[model samples]
Target chain A: MSGVEFVPLSLTPLLIGVFSAVACALPGNFLLLRRQALIGDAISHVVLPGIVVAFLVTGVVTAWPTMIGAALASLVAVVMIEAVRRLGRIEPGAAMGLTFTAMFAGGVLLLEQSDTSGVHLDVEHALYGNLEALIWLDAVGWESLLDPVALAGLPDELLRIALTLVAVGVFLWVCWRPLKLSTFDEAFAQTLGMRTSWIGLALVVVAAIAAVAAFDAVGSIIVIAMFICPPAAARLMTNRLEIQITWSVVFAVLSAVLGYILAGYGPLWLGLDNAVSAAGMIATVSGLILAACALWAPCRMRSGAPAQ
Target chain B: MTVELISDQGIAPDARHPEESPLAIRGMTVSYGQKPVVFSVDMTVQEGSMTAIIGPNGAGKSTLLKAALGIVTPLAGQAKVFGKPLRSQRHRIAYVPQRASVDWDFPTRVIDVVLMGLYRELGLLRRVRKTHLDKATSCLERVGMADFADRQIGQLSGGQQQRVFLARALAQGADLYLLDEPFAGVDAATEKAIIAVLKGLRADGKTVVAVHHDLATVHEYFDRVFLINTRKVAEGSVAEAFTPDALDRAYGGRLATAQMDRAAS
Candidate 1:
């Protein structure tokens, strides 16, 4: 509980978790309302292959190439899903299910076959991430907060997720009107010459960016959960889009902070020797919040319909 | 009842000014997959008229409107609005899609949905001003939905939902209004309110086109009628184009005898 242990061991990971949660949840609000929440799951599942492909092509486990690889993979997955939906005359859910699972299976096969013994590239690492290992080794105490030398040693994932969060926020703010109009009524937006198809594509691209970035930091469990749970729970709390968004952000932050603490300390409180997976714990907490909202939120039931 | 058979050639010649027609479609053909839903068809709406697009089920009545607005791609031909392409003249046109087209449960109020009609004027990043709010409120009032401004959209009945959509179109303040099946499922009062609003728009020199299904009210509601069955069957004033022969051709013998008698009466 001292500054020495908390600052060096917990600060960066906690910030990274919060940043990742918010980034995913912001776009998740629109996606959930638009009925495209599965796109988040699709993007996260395909990112593993993207990173593996990047390592194969560049022969390194660096950041930029892997990020680009993940982004490209998601784009390909989206296009493929659309193609299958159109050509095969299948529903979007089935197309997305078929595409992401195939790509993910391909990624696991590649990881098993490739000579990755020298690197920390495995399916488990991709799924749960290494949040516990991302410690600020150079920090001496709380004074490191203002010390340039110690701050420089902070985990790069923290900075990446923070930047992604800011980018996602700006995207939502700038395109707020068009996005809302399009999501609610695509035909109306198109009739007004709003290029609604482009707006829809842009939204999916932004969601893919958030998913890829968050997947790298908090792993796919938290990425998928954050993309749907917070926004869905917020949906039950309010009737206004603006207020719903605020509630989603509040829920995201609460889930990240509380979930991280519970994962790190709750087992110790119960006298267990070790901690649990932060990503899994965050996802579980978000699910719990959504369940509670569904059970008790005032606006949870549809108008004129009996509660099931 | 004796049925008068009008000549099949009812295509109106292109207006010399073109600007006088609020909507002009030329040889528009739309298809879904390999099956053509709407064949090469031409339609010209006189300015300041309330025209009804009537056809039987699967007759592509909605597809024609969607194709005209570029919401659905046409296989061939183009649509002009006031002598220009639809894209350049989008701001001067408004559309009210089918009531069943959107999810009413979306998290928005009635006033907010109406405000969407003014999206073009508001543009991006411009704060909604007092004038925009006033315009939306006035539109809602015109449609008799002002009382439901703060109500969630899902809380309204089917007829109220239709009225809200009309209110949104009214806020567009366009010269030409295109609506699809505005009276498909509504109470008698909502239908009366909607027709009154459409008549007001026409009296103010605004053009109105709607895909209407109720045969009994066609003569009473529309100033003109365009009959279609994959292609143009007849078009002109309701007395001229809504003849029994044209109805039989468009309905392909599917018009029940009682419905035809009601339509004639």
Candidate 2:
């Protein structure tokens, strides 16, 4: 076989997978920092009502309204969680569990009432995401920006990827210190004149947006997984905030691409399910990566230069 | 100590208010669950003075500090700083919690922790600029940890950890400082270094309140001591307030013996 054919027909899955991983990873760092690792799982579950409501209201499953509705719902979910904490004085984990479960149940009820039954609106797809469709969508190229030197069109997936990358880049850049300080010690951050409430809310909103964008491409489950696993792994490896973020993004992107390829072929060779379940497989891969990093990190730290 | 303020003597009636004072707690009360730990207590701390609240264990020393800083709500009382409430003047205060309170496994460096002190000053949605880094370096230098600026806080000795917190407080440059158990688990050298810095703060006209457990260092380390046991027993200069009569009143009969031993040593 020629090198070109062996280039991998599953390149689209890799692109979408990596993007989803990275998008979730940024917020994952903050979640872990704030000791809110389960928040990602909670947010994904709570966003269900928003998704179903958007579909019910519009009678269509388009991008804009679904995303906007989900974003607003995510914000509401966060507000409800905080309110519960204040009124009940309960631990955050218990509060989140309570809030997300109620919202998720409401979403299921709404879905049943609306009768928007289809492959597109399935709960499993909402939670785990559908990687196969995203890869196919990405393979078809879109119009490119006009160039004076080379007159060539760029792919639509490339354009989307570029836009998403720039958005994540700018967002992370602007909010770096506030994110770090707020994550490290929220009360201290409040003392320093930081708007701890606003920062926390903003992080939740950003995480929701990233999940929404990646949901269709990588699916919800894998996005949630990538958002959590990379940062947890990175925490085991380094003490520096900057280094942890850098390593987390690296690990996230690598896991996404590798998982895509592995899921594509592993089933046929190993007599597993033909469906492959790309989102679950990617999450499993990232989880394994975190485990491996934890196991080897102590030895690496001992042999390498001391923590600075 | 005769226990007389300038306000009481009528030399300066306004001295009682102390507008410049960083902390003013009036009728403060705190409770965990149903049991009240800190009863209604009133105190006014002058600006730029090193004041220590010394008491035996379970005397609500840390609880009082936490209530003043708004970490724990006062059931009935109000705490203010610089003539403003703690919420409004949060940026002007730096809190150095007990060294043993947090997990040492937290992933961060000494510089990172110190940088947190500057968070309020840097405001929100902005990265730490070169100016912030320079300030952090200078603060580390003040604590004689300039060489270890990049080191992880977990890798440091107990003394080093204490110094690191002091450096963080310095980086804040706040008008008020609330420290909880700063002297705990620290070596003699670390205690001396911390005291020197605190004394310098008092001289600079910044208010410092520490939750102190050692009675022996009351005279040496503090300009003023507030002996608290659930309620305010006495707050005045060390010579007058650290007397056997006041100690007995503050600690009761059981602790009076411990106080006697400390005094004898």
lDDT per residue for candidate 1 within A1-308, as digits (tens), equals: 89999999998888888889999999999999888899999999999889999999999998898899999999999999889999999998899899999999999998888888899888888788777777899898899999999999998888899899999999999999999999989999999888887888898999999998888887888989999999999999998899999999999999999899999998999999899998888888999999999999989987833111
Grade the docking of candidate 1.
acceptable
- TM-score of B-chain for each predicted structure, in order: 0.91, 0.89
Interface RMSD for model 2 amounts to 5.2
- In model 1, what lDDT does residue B153 have? 91
lDDT scores in order: 0.90, 0.76
TM-score (0 to 1) for chain A, all models? 0.96, 0.85
- lDDT digits (tens) for residues B1-265 of candidate 1: 0011122244342344455468999999999999999999999987778999998888999999999999999999889998898988999899999988888888999999999998888888888899999999999999899999999898999899999999999999899999999997788999999999999998888889999999889989998999999999999899899999999999887889637754653
* Model number with the top DockQ: 1
**Candidate 2's residue-wise lDDT over A1-308, tens digit each?**
34233222355556777877888898888888777777777778877899888888888887777777777787888889889988999999999999989999999999888878663787887867666654332122222112322212222343454466667767888888877766656666655656777888778777777766776455668867877899988877787767888999989987887777678778877877685777888899899999999888642352122222
Q: Pick the candidate with the highest TM-score.
A: 1
Provide the global lDDT of candidate 2 against the true structure.
0.76
Quality class of the docking in candidate 2, CAPRI style: acceptable
